[model samples]
Target: MAGEEFEYEYLYKALAKYANEHQYPLAQQAYEGAGAAEKIHAAILKEAANVKTYEGTTVYVCPICGYVMAGDSIPERCPVCGGPERQYEKF
Candidate 1:
């Protein structure tokens, strides 16, 4: 999982860099979203390593955006994309 995260991080960073250099704002935003998603995934892995358990926890992923949140309940809106709670998919 860590290796996958790093791969995605590297890929998104490269995409973002290339898109920005070529003045593709939309592509850059999409790459940024992908990068943000990987970052959240990495953070969750780090947290899991520290806690050593996923019991009594919930992970929510936004469908419209790559936003992710771990908690007891889904957030009212995605922090990254402002999607509603109903748009989130639980994992």
Candidate 2:
């Protein structure tokens, strides 16, 4: 889970870079958390800043079920539904 979050940070940085390169104010603005979008915006901002802390990192969600995968990588099997790693999705 930790590694995945780290990876997502990389994704975020890439997104931010793209947003900056294209001068997409909405994307840039989307990086800033506000109201209902606060959590997502914060994640994007963390990526932009190259944040390394998962203290506030959001957990991965399993598309197969409502299970939340926190910590690092997806488990070998879902404790809730016995789904494989492929069942998990980034938040």
Best-performing candidate as measured by TM-score: 1
Backbone clashes, candidate 1: 0
Q: RMSDs, each prediction? A: 2.4, 12.4
lDDT (C-alpha, whole model) for all candidates: 0.81, 0.55
Flag clash pairs in model 1: none
lDDT of 2: 0.55
Candidate 1 wrong stretches, greater than 4 Å: 4-9
Tally clashing residue pairs in candidate 2. Answer: 5
Residues 1-91, candidate 2, lDDT per residue (tens digit)?
Answer: 3444553466545665678789996774444212213334345555656856657555776565445655565578765456687767766
TM-score for candidate 2, please give it.
0.35
